[model samples]
Target chain A: MEQYEKIYLYKRIVKAKLFIDDHYAENIDLGNICDQANFSRFHFIRLFKSIYGSTPNNYLIKTRMEKAKILLAKGHSVLETSIMVGFDSPTSFAGMFKRIAGQTPSSFQKKQHAQKNAMQLNPLLFVPNCFAENNGWTK
Target chain B: MITKITHTCIYVLDQNSAYDFYVNKLGFKVHTDAPMGEGARWLTVTPPEQPELEITLFLVAEGGMFDEETVQIMTTLIKKGTFGAAVFTCKDLLATYEELKSKGVVFKKPPTKEFYGYEALFLDDSGNWFSLAQINS
Candidate 1:
């Protein structure tokens, strides 16, 4: 491919990725993503996988799960989080979350809640020792 | 007095991947790509709009340019993402940020309004981060 063509292709591929980044909360699929990039399904999958190192569906699921993690950490219930991140069923959400995050939704939320409470109790305890000492905060 | 600084170096973990990141992702053009004996390459690239400056993509291999210990330490430091080597200016911070992010550039910061300018930070393939800024003039 010519240099300009390569640049154009990359711009299109990046556009598809940005679309996924923006609309991961929506019901997105291979067709929607490929439309954003102007590529056919199989060819788009090839290009997207080569560049981003994951298929579009996997990337979409990962994106939603990542946002779900933040929402879960912020004390949102698993059912609510699943809905928020566009998951239809909490069971599927919990299953996928466990697969990707290595813990059940409730357990992760509990850990985050415990950590938040502990931090609130002694804010300094959560601060890294080196970071505190760097500004003479330890002394 | 020196007329201009033409060349600089960024120590990379793997030269081929760095080439892909710089040329394919960042739209830099390869200025020089050649072998310097013993399976090492003397590779350099230039930003698309700035051909005058050659950014040498020096490989951190333990052979001719460095010893085994030095290579180990350098790789460790680069992997830790410690270096902030250069500042690249862009016309529009937000657009460039989005564009680069799509190309898999790992950004450390989103564009924010600092006193000096609107600046964001991103890491290259080999873990050397850069400051992408749009100065308020």
Candidate 2:
């Protein structure tokens, strides 16, 4: 492809991505996303996958999974996190989460909680000793 | 006290093309070019008139905040011209447009009278578009 053509295609793909990022919590479909990019559904899917290596539907699921992970880590209930991530059912959410994350939401949350507690117990572990010394800490 | 934005990202399809477009066509200065681990480079450039702010030429790839799936989505969006990266100001929009065009920069729209001022639209090497405007003083 020519450089200009490549640039133009990349820009269209970016539009679809921005739409997904902004509306992942809502019920977003491939047609609406393609509309945002001003590309037909067939061409959009083909080009999107060729450029980024994933289909639009897969991309949406991945984005939702990422957001769900954040909410789960923050101590949200499984049902709430699933709903917030736009999943219609907790069972489906759990299934997807396990497939992508390799653990159930509850297990992920427990691991996050343990990690949080560890960080809190040894805050210095996260902060450099030089930072404390520069701020006037003796030890 | 609040200061200025030190860094901003402009996602591009290719870093080499972006480098040529921004540095050669736009006449911007390279601020930083360093390795960012994981086969990514931290590339940033600054406009000639605005040295404090750095325009990071971030490549849209499958790393950092993106996974295999998310990277595909972002790459497609960028290629479609979905990202209007930023608005640039120039002392003379007409002269700047001409100069940039002479250096092989492609402008979607030439400098024309907009409601706010005279402006033009141009695409960077990575599919991110920007508005080159001379706001009315």
lDDT of 2 by residue, A66-91 (tens): 78977887799999999999989999
DockQ of every candidate structure? 0.05, 0.03
Writing each residue's lDDT as its tens digit, candidate 2 over B7-122 gives: 77788889988888887678687766654345666577999768778887877777445678978998989988888989998865655665567567789898888888899999
Model 2 chain A, poorest ten-residue lDDT window? A130-139
Which parts of model 2 are misplaced by more than 4 Å?
A: A1-139
Per-residue error for B97 in candidate 1, Å, reads 7.1
The candidate maximizing lDDT is 1
TM-score of 1: 0.53
The top-ranked prediction according to TM-score is 1
Local distance difference test scores for all models: 0.81, 0.78
Pairs of residues clashing in candidate 1:
none
DockQ of model 1 vs. true complex: 0.05
* lDDT for position A82 in model 2: 94
